[model samples]
Target: MNTIKTIYLILCIFAISFLSRFWMSEWKWYAQFLRLKLKSKEEPDVGFDNKRDADPNKILQEADDIYQLISSTKPLFDIPPFERSTSAHNSKYYIMNPTEVHSTGNLLYTYVETYDYQGNRKTTGGDFFRARIYDKKTLTAAVGSITDFNNGSYLVTFPLYWEGTVYISIKLQYSSEMVSLIHRLRDIDNYRMGFRGIFLSKNYKEMTKCHFNLTFTGPLCDLYYHNSGIKWMCEKPKNLSCENLSSLEYYFNEPSLSEAEKKFDDRKNVLKEIRPVGASSVIVKKQGSNINLPKCQSHPLTYTNSTGFVQNHTWISSLCQVKRFRTSERVIQCIKGKKIYLVGDSTIRQWFEYLVKIIPTLSKVNVGRNQWYSEKLAVDLTNNIYLQWRTHGLPWHPGVPLMLPDSPSAVSLINNIYGGKEFITVICLGAHFTRYPLKVYLETLIHVRNAVKRLLGRSPDTTVILKNGNTRTPYKLLLDNDWLTYELNQAFVAAFMGMNVSLVDAWDLTAAYESAELHPSEEVIKNEVDVLFSYICPNID
Candidate 1:
């Protein structure tokens, strides 16, 4: 009896220890989130209405314009799948200029003519195409710029940056009908994810359905953020008041695509992954060494920004000089005395993760047991380097459920910072926005832009970096497709056209290196951070 009792006690202690750790781990990020919010609440949350005065029609119109700018490919909501699917095997492509030897300084273009399974040339443009010119021997690749002429034909342009035999490849990610179906689904419902709001008080505890959009037919407590005017809703509690809302839990909401939409996201289907109809490769020779490129340092990216190509697995930016801080000592020195703030999707979170890893002196606070969860903080006391990152609001489908307050817009993060020369803010958005509709994205953009305006208004010397969207593969769910990412990025570029903040061209950075993963490889992340710091410490080189 004594031995059995001791064993039971031991098991109880072990279980208690395990659960205590788990509970603490789960709650730390939320604790930090609240602390951060409280510290920054001094900035009046005038709410979202003032900044959201953007003409809805104009914003939607601009969204349409971005699609046309990328390719004359609009979603075919009314078209049938049979008429819209492009046949990869039936399609054909050829080099416009198949000369014996291509010059490094010259321009090369290819015309890809997409066809249906029936070998009929497509009349409307909506095919998802990705092009790259790469040399296997040197491991050099440059993403090809594609122009959909609204007809079946697309113009793929490549700059001959190096002297080598480079092969050209094109892939049809989705058919026009499929793309159209995806768009139609976007307008049908705004709910991508769902949440359960847990309201707690002295004697009552309850959980109610909550979501960014209240598509459910029920009485809901429509609540708005007192400061930013951001709105959120939850099913009305049976007896408890909505004011008792204390915590939130999230669940992944399946896209639930219809039969036609299912074909586009399925890899087993022939409608996707069509990579044929193009010349294998061409050779080129360097003309001269007359190009004296400037460093990567720049204020804001421009239309005519010079994008130097990658050579020998390194990004050589012609936009401005780039100083690669490869060593820990170099990174420390460059970022010393700098308080860097990162917010947005997991991409920005990558920087926070990388920084703490590379710099031994930088210690990450135990914000949460789940490393993947957002709301992170790291401090380098000796260097006076403070680093923090948070995930953006709605449409954020983190593997772990986050409290409502933990999931906030980048605007909230931006507003909280006390900007100065010592502070550097890097915002990487649009990854989550890529899959959202135009109107939703435009409203979010207005909020972010206005927050940036406020940040700059107070501290003009603060260095602001807007990390644009990176290229990602269109997998079973094309939610974060390469084309959609680009479309949203262009919108960001247009939204913050003249803003003081520099919109870092992540598209070119990722594409030039052929980094296509939604969460790209760490090497790509490194290059991106290097590019970001190039502005933070332009003289590091």
Candidate 2:
């Protein structure tokens, strides 16, 4: 009887321990699954226009309503998906540097470091580090927010210019002893691996720190750091032939990865991989000199006190011409009495902001605070047209037609607005569809097209431009570090045709910045908007 009792207790303990570990993993997985499901199902909420004399509860109710509005509205823009590589034994780390350029606005710079065992199918351990930035200056506010974190990427608007250099670092800690146990269990397969980090700083100064440490279970094979920013060590400490970083050529033994994979220079898919071109690199291609476009009256664009921007005096089809398009006048126009509406995503906001700065001839114009949801400018011109922007988030299917009054509120809203005047609706939506399957994206477009058809019944002059989705580093989050901007750009342009809508090839214009940083300079913006401008009003000011 005693022996039987002992066996029963032992079995119960083993079962409980086994279930506990599984429960931990399962709980973690369920939490992640719910979060992702919510993220994928994006819907923004509308805002409440609360009255001035509303009581405290009314305000609170309005706040709740606003939350609902934000919840239902679609996100026009989103960060890249932070997905782990499927390889079980490997681990990947992402390096992010937030940048704010005047032309490119604000953006997060991302670089990836991947580590793997000799032969493993799974990537593991790699986790997110939690940290924050503090502003010591006058604002007395926290500069960074954990709420802005979407998956692995975080949000940062342009830090105020006066804030000075921001003191920023990371806080990371290992979770669960199982990872440590796994490391010990796979001792023979482990090998030393190095990662090259890339990031951009607010200051143009090239100096930066590489903070790291290593744990070893075996004999210390080597230890060295070079001025060339390369480090390596061999079995014997006295022997140091690895200092010649320039001569070091990385060759991949496995056929699955490319030659560029060995070296950290795998970021080029559109352009050939070129070594880091310093300040003195010569330009090999000539810009538009032979184009028949009229030359600008203003030679080498002079800065204007009125607009606080450089004015281009010429009209050329090349990148040089477009970046400088804002030089003389805003290239957008509202017909004397009709509403000119710019609808779709935040990328359209760039166009909206550009139009606001350039169009000076309008007599009466009312501007409101900009929201990611939408922006409106009532222009009193020969044609009293309200220049309006209506933003929709992902799953931007304009909704079903003639289905029911409450079925598609978004489409119903557009139909309600389309009562009388011939509205000029310029739409460019599709950037938020990276994670969404292409079939789903196309189906959404079909719904949108049907809505447009119902609203503006085949009016020839009623212009509708469907700009192909803007291009970005698609697999950046996956550490597939191949920046194939041109290839992807070409693919986007070729893909969208015969939809009976005017196609603006914004991606092609953006390809000029292939070798440049992730952000587009003034040149790239001009090129993109020029296509729209040419489609709308081709004549130079």
Best by lDDT: 1
Models 1 onward score TM values of 0.81, 0.37
- In candidate 2 the C-alpha lDDT for residue 506 amounts to 50
Candidate 2 residue 253 Cα shift, in angstroms, is: 33
State the lDDT of candidate 2 residue by residue for 368-404, as single tens digits: 3324343345564544545766554332222221111
| Residue 255 alpha-carbon offset, candidate 1, angstroms | 4.6
What 10-residue stretch in candidate 2 is worst by lDDT?
A: 301-310
Name the weakest run of 10 consecutive residues (lDDT summed) in model 1. 32-41
Model 1: residues >4 Å from true position, as ranges? 1-72, 202-204, 215-230, 252-261, 269-278, 303-308, 368-370, 473-478, 512-516
**What tens-digit string does per-residue lDDT give for candidate 1 at 51-78?**
3334454444544444344333455555
Native RMSD of candidate 1 (Å): 18.1
User: Highest TM-score among the candidates is held by which one?
Assistant: 1
